[model samples]
Target: MKKVLTACLLFVSSLTFAQQTVQRSAKLPNSDITETFSVLRSDKKIKQGEYTATAGNNTTLAQGTYLNGERAGIWSFYNISGKLIQTYNYTDNQLTFADSTDTKGLQYVMAGVKTDDDVTVPVKIGGSYSFRPTFLSKVLTQAINKDFGPVANATFIHTFSLNSKGEVTNHQVKVCINGQNKLYQVDDSELDHDLTRFAPAMVNNNPIPCKVITTNTVAMSNGNLPDYANSTYLGQ
Candidate 1:
């Protein structure tokens, strides 16, 4: 068994009751969240440590640290497809930053996002519960594999623009393999699936246009990385 000593922690908490580090996983009470956190070696109670919660498919939902059983430090919250939505700084007692900038990275990319008063993004009719299993898994995985040839494992970044009418256009995809990225402007026929539906972005009772971005990590395994389930993703 692996062990880590909370040397000063035990001295302060229980006069030498050092805590043992062990791998622990459980579902949060009254919630669909399953999480992993550190617990006392002797008492088995949650101790100060890193905390992570994930969706049923093992997609990360929230990530942060816990101090004396309370959430501490920076906490990042994400939507179902793994796009970062917001972050809070617990240690400084600040709400920190909402995802206001265009999500940019080598493996993933999205463009042209501005934070204006009350300008909100579009939403799919059934949220992620309906979106992921229905569109993402089937559309991206099956479509990409069939169209691009049987890729055993890879990462995908899909970005598309939506108008006030909720009509999504300019769909583009970037396939990351071995750190090399190939960008593809996909046609509806090439993808072999419809781009799903969206409700429409809103601003002060009126609809607005916005961009939809998502990242998916696909690894063929027993379960670690589900299709599009990321570290997780930089969705917007």
Candidate 2:
């Protein structure tokens, strides 16, 4: 009997803590949010010593490391059900790693966004209700302003999709230069990450997947955009 009990104890010890969400406040004014600091033990791997953000329904919205109350390292954003929507690499509070051609990577401004079918789209839910564009923009602006600094000189265009469970997927970004919509180089990692901080989407009083796209401009002192003449073709 002792041997059997000892074996069970060892098995339990191998498992990590249960996933949990906690409410936390930012020292900076008007930045309160729910944080999932749990060290979750997934079947494939164990995620320890990282912080995750969640909405009111306990769906993971963002995941990253925090140093002295500031976001650090590669942060991942998810839809309402924890699907990876976007990833942002940061260092010393500055957004980095803005160059990629992956579907989830940044793109030079191009002009072909396909339209969705006539199905009922998911609604952006906040707390016990849906979110208005103005409020959503306000929340996104706070995170962008804090992490990526000002963006008065460039436009960030981001697109993503959510599954029927309101989980985000198929994340992408694009950049525009010179105030023209035809900008190049994708540099909207911070914008995408911040946008994931909102509540999940819902349809017919139930969570449903949907697509989201947002555009925002920042005012920096630069007027010349990066010239990637050898850039990969968009269709590639």
Candidate 3:
């Protein structure tokens, strides 16, 4: 019985390690970069195992492991000078390190619809609130409870923002109370959940502070409140 179990374990291990995958290489279209990676033998499209992209000058642009089809494990991004710029762990969903000073990486991961890398803004780890990994809901709930009172059928314009350091800053809210426009500053600290760990926005593989501007309509959250002067509207 012991021998049978051991044989089965080894068989499974062999299947996992020596599977139907082949190493392949491809030159990027219109680019001097070549990518060496593994793909499924049956379908040449599904990437598996270790993957690397190199420039024409023999510089490693990007290297990471891909499990089946998605990016897995820790991926290290290098600057143009081949300097280690950042390491992001997809399994743990965290950024290990980021060098904000290095503006030129051997490679760059440009994302979003913006072509101007200099003005690209920072983004939260989670693309949306539902996918966010921070305690944003808790923080926002606290702010609404303190400033807006409670959740009702009313809605308010709440700008839940964070600083370049990925910390909860002075988020604001705009609401009309008693026919007067009021703006309240909700000061909250990110002692528990910080945004930096999510590998925030980087320009040319350089980690820098960026602000995410979002117009959030918090409905059924901010309730009745006292009237305030027009100047109190976040000083306009």
Q: Pick the candidate with the highest TM-score.
A: 3
lDDT of candidate 1 vs native? 0.55
lDDT of 1 by residue, 1-236 (tens): 12335665555675433345554788543234577887666556655577777786677877777666566778776765687766666576454555543233312222344455465555543234223432243354455555555444667777767777666666677877656677766544322121244556677667767777777665655332234443233343
Instruction: List per-prediction Cα lDDT, in the order shown.
Output: 0.55, 0.41, 0.51
Q: Which number leads on lDDT?
A: 1
lDDT (tens digit, per residue) of candidate 3 on 1-236: 99999999999986875587888998643244577998888778788889886766687867889887777888876644577766778788776665655321111233353665664334333222111222123444454356546433323444544444554454565654334455656443332242223344556666554433333222342353222110011211
Could you tell me which 10 consecutive residues in candidate 2 have the lowest summed lDDT? Answer: 126-135
| Candidate 2: tens digits of C-alpha lDDT, residues 1-236 | 99999998877764423233223332111123355443333322223456766554566666677543445677765554555545555453332332121223312221222354223333232211111122223334443444444344556666655565554455554555444443222222333243433323443445455566655444444332211211111321
* Model 3 whole-model lDDT (C-alpha atoms): 0.51
User: Clash number for model 2?
Assistant: 10
Residue 74's lDDT within candidate 1 is: 80
TM-scores across all candidates? 0.38, 0.30, 0.41
The pairs that clash in candidate 2 are 79-168, 151-218, 151-219, 152-218, 152-219, 153-218, 153-219, 153-220, 163-209, 176-183
